[model samples]
Target chain A: MAYFDYLPHLVLFTIGTLIGLEISYKWHSEPFVKKKIEPVPLILALIGGGLMIFYAPLGLLFIGFVIGMRPGYGIYESVIGILFALILWVTL
Target chain B: MYYPVNFNLIYILLEIITAFIFGGLLLGLHRKVMARIQGRPGPPIVQHLLHTFKFYIKELSIPNTSSMPLYVAIVLAMDAVWILALIVGPILGGSFLIIIMCYAVHKVAEHGIGLASGSPYTKLGSTRAVLSATAEMPLIAVPALVFFKTDTLLLDGIINYQIVNGSLFTQLPLVALAMFVLVLSKTPYSPFGIVWGKDIVSGYKTEHFGVIRGVMMMGEILAFFALLWCFITIFFGGIITAPLAYMVAMTGITVILAFICALTPMVAPYHAVMIQWIFAILAVVNVLLI
Candidate 1:
């Protein structure tokens, strides 16, 4: 079967990640006001990245990067991002 | 043979409910065991469940320095990962690879919470958590070796192989030893628990309070159950055929772990990492030679 067959799985994963990020951005942002980089546009980028997972292993790496670059970036956060990327690359 | 994806939503729901309820009971039991080891009267065995409910009724407070979104996301994500791991890894006979992936995602939750908190203590905890993850990576070889022996990646397949050929632990004692070491580090109160030790005011959880803290606590209970379930399934044999055996083994291991934790002094993060690395190397050599 082609990797695209797993598109539903990828969509679910992307949706889960976006929901998680949007919740974080909405409730946790300082002043709780409108931000320049709202989470909706970012969700589109995440969907694009998730679709890319079918083309090459680098897709998960991109998704991980986007996740790490979200607000509240830190050293351990980046480390985990890389770890998740590597895991998805190897497993999926 | 791939089964049709029926996706019984009710089964999944029931499984999750049972896991959390039993998981909370196990956590409370662990606390009581630890208290007895320290010569103190412990709270009731249902203390953890009560505490979690108390947090639900309490006001939610977000620390000013914290990233609220990430904080909440980490807790919820951690709980989700554990639930999936338990259901898929052991219950539904999923691949060992998926189990490992779930574990990796769990580490992400841990790292995110510590980093999002913006507390120095949590930062230190996050750094140590990273170090621990690095050290724990080699233990993945345990499953790899199991795959080599069983010629299958599914937990059910491994259990069947044991039923036919003999226990994996007996055949591969060194891998069992390595897994024991990994389990020890994962257990609370161990020297490896510096991330949550008193020295750091509960480490990554220092900034979390009220309902959020409760969610984290629930995640922890579920995580512990997942680990213990994995251990019993992979090392001792399948819990399906031997439920009582698994329970006895779980209780025995918990008490022994608590005793070791009470007796041992907390080790520095560097020291803990070094020790795990040494064990990992030994496991590698064992896998290569045997």
Candidate 2:
């Protein structure tokens, strides 16, 4: 039952991660027809965003990762993710 | 025991003077901090003031390619709208609705200036400005959330509610965070600096110089202070009692924002819009949860 309580946050984290991956892929592969997509940042965003939903402080480190990968993942988007996690922490 | 209407007018005049002085100082301080972060000695704290003074003495030249009347009118109008917005903002305890309207008017002025200038660079900047404004529309949720929590749309009423209860920052940390992010993005140097980023050669002000540019710059600084004041009043009103404390909080926010700006690379316009929508959705969800 406790696991069910965390399901919504987990789902949000998963969705956010997938969206981040898609956006990052599109950003790097733009203007070229067959450029290979980089999956490292995508994987990191997924793992870090999931960790963030369960542990708020980890989101701060995730923010640093997002900032470091400029033009791929937006700092503001990471901020929004962290804020959503914080909201879930307070409410659910 | 109430004074005459003229006394109120006098107070308003004094308030405007204080706002301008401090707004210029804050802009100078922001430049100084940002430069220091980049490992360079920055300009003096009054550099913005000195620049404005120089603009006053410089010769004015309306671009031959520009629509002269529209260009001049929009610049003046932008300054006027910002002045009114600052007056109605939390600094003056006016209605929040009026403040929002003033900001919308300011955007119109921004668009008008860009279109009237007739430069390709300014046009591109204007397009990005429109995109940014669309993305920033979500910021209206800040006041809406406040109204929902306090049952009033007036700045004074919101502050009073916070005093009766505790700080909104403690009770609604998510909303507070969302609002802070919104404010930071709108600040001069954050990633949203796309409107004035190097690609556009100072963006919409590309064709503007001399006195007209000075007026726009003044308006920008004033708008910054008004937004910062509104943020403090809405979130930290319960804890900040004195004017000095308000100044300190504003400086802290500015310094922190400078650090963020110095560290983060500017995001593209599409990414900026996406980020704002994500933030807006999170804020709306948080409000519903509340």
Candidate 3:
């Protein structure tokens, strides 16, 4: 099965990303893209990430966070996740 | 698998309206509880609905600094995304993944809202919203978890899976926890609400007012309704047997989330990002183990 079956959704999401860029361009101080925050690249990254998630739900999103997120994965997400997983695994 | 032929468009339309009315009342109740918890006498439970009404009757107010039309277009686009969510989620019983697509688009609309407003505060809000999306990204693991558990990604299929084997909420609760976190993160004033934090003076919406604000509020109401609807359909599939029961579940969830929102202080920006990422990673590892 082709992943692009959900192409309309991808189009709408892209249009939204473009709209955000236009808004940023209009009001941003530097004229093109903001310098300090670098929203353009960030927006591109979001679009890129969204595309990956759409194309492949099984994508390893955890690896990225696992790398930047020290403490051997994550504290709140990991701890609460493990705690709940254990309780449910044992009880259910 | 959709069995769409059985659904009456008019009947579903009426239910959407019913969901809207009840959603507003429940949100008002959310505020009342939050206020009483904080030791202050809150406005009437109907205050939120009244404000939504007032914003419509009141004149439209665009900021002097904002560029023409883009400000208004952003507001309408915000509503459009949720309206799409309403269609796919509650009306059509579309795939679960599409709802996430709508959420991704909504994030962009939110980011644009701050930038289009032309205020420094609004700019900060836009930046914060984008930054906040980073923390929230881990939640994308949710649909993946559901797909793994149910062996199907369609909303109707998942609901049917629950109806037969019992809810995923009980069978694989980690998914529910991730969803609850997503709901809390998206809730109006929850601890994860960094986009509209007080310190930023209304955050991204600092400059949006009057009809513009009202339109945004309407979109928000729809967004809230759609989120709850999806959550109920996804996790508590048993309740769909009774329409009224389904609504009651929505209200019940709102009340529970409201208490959590009221009690928790706003997370610091960096910490909020860190916590969200942590939640996502946890979800991935747990699901992989499962």
> lDDT of all predictions, in order shown?
0.68, 0.71, 0.70
- After superposing the true interface residues, what Cα RMSD does each candidate give? 16.7, 21.4, 18.4
True-vs-predicted CA distance for residue B187, candidate 1, Å: 2.0
Candidate 3's residue-wise lDDT over B39-80, tens digit each? 764655445666887888887767788878888998899888
RMSD of each: 19.2, 16.7, 20.5
Candidate 1 C-alpha error for residue B215, in Å: 1.3
| Higher-ranked by lDDT: 1 or 3 | 3
Classified by CAPRI criteria, candidate 2 counts as: incorrect
TM-score of each: 0.71, 0.73, 0.72
Cα lDDT tens digits for candidate 1, B60-163: 87778888778788889987887788778645777878878887887777788899988899887887788888878888778887787789988888888777
Ranking by lDDT: 2, 3, 1
TM-score of the candidate numbered 1? Answer: 0.71
Please name the candidate that would achieve the greatest lDDT relative to the true structure. Answer: 2
Across B200-248, the per-residue lDDT of candidate 2 in tens digits comes to: 8878878888998888878877788787887888889888756667777
The fraction of correct interface contacts reproduced by each prediction comes to: 0.00, 0.00, 0.00
